[model samples]
Target: MAFGTVARASKRFQAFDLLATLVVVIRHDGTIVFANSALEDALGTSRRTLEGAALGNFFVDAGTLRTAIDGARTNDFATLRYEAQLRRGTQEPLPVQVTLAQTDRKAELLLEMSPQEQQVRQDREVRLLDQAQANKELIRNLAHEIKNPLGGIRGAAQLLQMEIESRDLIEYTQVIIHEADRLQSLVDRLLAPHRRPHVVGDVNIHEVCERVRSVLLAEFPHDLEVERDFDPSIPEFRGDREQLIQATLNIAHNAAQALAERRAAGDARITFRTRIARQVILNKQWWRLALELHVIDNGPGVPDSIKDRIFYPLVSGREGGTGLGLTLAQTFVQQHHGVIECDSVPGRTDFTILIPLP
Candidate 1:
């Protein structure tokens, strides 16, 4: 029955295409019979090509995978797991937790590959987004507390400055009023993300990218490169156009600032890349499809000293930086049920934003 159906099978493989995990079906002799889209992407090959290929040939520790397959074939274990590095055609070997399972067919097996730390970080992103909501409320309450007293303090200081006789005394009152006004401004910025109304509509991500690109280029105008490497097949998704624009702009603006030296030397470059991600998980929910935008730069990367805490309020890497750009960007993306993550080294930095599609 199985052999008869092979010509017309794959009615159920459609569901596996939507799974985040990479899966491949193996024949008893270790030849791959079927591979899902995720597996095809991980291997960077076509399904037709991967079929009938030796499954063990794609791993650095290929022997272990072959052994697991042999064990599964003999019913030694229903599922055997071993850590192996899956070798991509042109990329580095990927660390994955490999699982081998016996299928209903006597010689058939299923192999699953789950990327190691990437999944852990994604899980933590969900947790952080959960914390993001709490932080949002805290920011709102803190802003209101500071805002209510600011007006009174500034008014009192202004009145005292007028009544003071000594010039030094007037100067002291002026400082008081000036400091109060600064704090008020900070409070206003802290409250901006929460108070802004989300104007939802059909938002073309490329349009947002172009808008930000134009603004950034106009500001710098020379000595820097801003490139677009977009996948045109990424369909339009629902989102707030203005908020996404701000999010992208905030990240790109920071990159431009960090690239000041390189910009002056005519070596700075920032690239905007867009792709469609399948089977993405966000904020404890699963999404079959998502929009991915990468803001990459060739500046000195985020400093290691504060790389982990860069998203926290008032944490600034640059002098005189308000440190609110990334914070606000994260908040805006989180509001749209998306996430933003940063990966940085000395010469390369990537700020990636993921938004789920319906």
Candidate 2:
């Protein structure tokens, strides 16, 4: 009867192993006695290999593993935060956060990760929030100071044109009216995205990207190329459709402009890639899943002097640029509780957007 009871207990342990998130039971001597399915999947190793292996063998850094193990031994339950680089057969090292805990009978450690690919996502969100507030103030002041006077100037030019009888004089007045109208349109474009209503619903990210791509192709036609690499498995997320379209379009337009400048030099390219990342921490809160979209370009890259302030209102890199495109893009993405970040070097520039999924 005792042997039968032991056999039943072992079967129950095996059942629990298959269902848990991650469970690794280690002996007091620091050898792995049992590992669960989750643990095996995370480490990309089989149970047989892990059964007798030392717990520290999996950690990227020996010192961190020793410190965590020592802490767990002294305290009944202990947790240590450290990054472990996991080596899977031929794949690159995967960074993960290892949390070790101990009880009187067994010690268990939880391994999770915030992949480097998703780094700076939360920081981008905070920066976007700040940018949006700054833009609101900027638009209000600019509209009053600049946009209001634009109408008067255009009207004055019309009145002047009527009084001046000479053909040359009238032509000069016409130029003034045309220039004023151009500035008015620029300001309108800057404000249009902001005036859009907040329509919240399920948003298909690919649809947004496709819309941006079609618009960009129409605008640039022969000179530029826009490519897309999307993951159909990504589910619908919550956001405003028009706002996301404008936000993505702004970045793509900037890329097209940058590539145009490099067209005379060599072949230019812009790629839009999307994937899904898990276990991300955005705005100091953990998210189980987040959409990762990257707008990459091969151009001269953003000037270092203006790189840091590119998101600031009225900051522009191109001639005649209002510098509001990126500012508005940042604003709209932040409204969706997402982030947009840029990394530029000589030959490569990437604008990454991270939006949380429902």
Candidate 3:
């Protein structure tokens, strides 16, 4: 693994291979001493070819990288950072954020390149996490406030009905009591996730999917079709089995409802897919391996108007819908340090759930 005058310490650089970012160690003359696995994959080239090549040549504008390398050689600054277009074999040049710094070994410089899109995705995930935390606080406070008055309203209605001598008047009191009871139920559901402790245990994702599938089939036996595309290689991880089942069932049920027209046409289809993702980032943390479970449906997709707001509590596209299904699903998945994303168009809607795996 030796290149130029750099030391043969390939074993020392093995840690970089685990990183999602591309890293390369170069000599003072700008010849690559070592290239990480990430870099090799990004360039669509092997490490053997990358190790001896000039790192600058891989960039769209080599001059920018050359200047940055020269600056690193001198005591110009502790580190240098900039945006650059990286060239790959035949693919379009990729936009990346580049960072250059000197290593302990004076003769070698460490350079890191991360795709700009990846950075944006990480930022989005962080924002989603922050937003979820805020939502939890808001729901807890709001539910408690609603719960106190709700009990009083229902109790008062019950007492009023007992005192009412006129049958018509008693009927009105009954309506009040019934409506209050409904509101109470809604409040309880709003507070349900917070009330229950997250029970963790070994969870086989396939089992979760199968449970949801059987339930869905039983409910829509005549029309809806539930399919499975599971990866046998995915191993079981520690999580709440009940929570996962409920989360998956919520998404699948929503899809089934959305497929109302397709069901009548006898072509409603919902797919449960599972796969393993490697070197993935979720909730601002990196996982060497992650589980990607997708719930895809062939139906009239989520309405474009409310697509973005679908995950928000009490937001629903369907009429008379409580809209808590997707919200609870998102909350349950987040409890496992995962996230759910929805991609919808007119014909296809995909809900992907990603969770870090051991």
Would you give me the overall lDDT of model 2? 0.75
- lDDT winner among the candidates? 3
Candidate 3: which stretches are off by over 4 Å? 1-7
Q: What would the TM-score be for candidate 3 when compared with the true structure?
A: 0.93
lDDT of each: 0.86, 0.75, 0.90
Quote the positional error of residue 241 for candidate 3 in Å: 0.5
Give the C-alpha miss distance for residue 287 in model 2, angstroms.
Answer: 3.3
How well does candidate 2 score on lDDT at residue 250? 91
Q: Give the lDDT of residue 110 in candidate 1.
A: 82
- Which digits, one per residue and each the tens of the lDDT, describe model 2 over residues 1-358? 1446434534645853534244666655567666666567667898777877787777566666676676777774555666666566677766655556664454544433444444454456566566678878888668668888899999999999989899999999999999999989878876776677889988999989899999988987777778889999999987899888988899989988888766655476788899997655655566668899899999879999899889987798899888888988888887777778889998899998888786
Runs with alpha carbons beyond 4 Å of true place in candidate 2: 1-28, 31-42, 46-53, 75-128, 131-193
Residue range with the least summed lDDT across 10 consecutive positions in model 1: 1-10
Candidate 3 lDDT over residue span 185-219, tens digit each: 99899899888999999999999999999999999
lDDT head-to-head 1 vs 3, winner: 3
How would the candidate models be sorted by TM-score, starting from the highest? 3, 1, 2
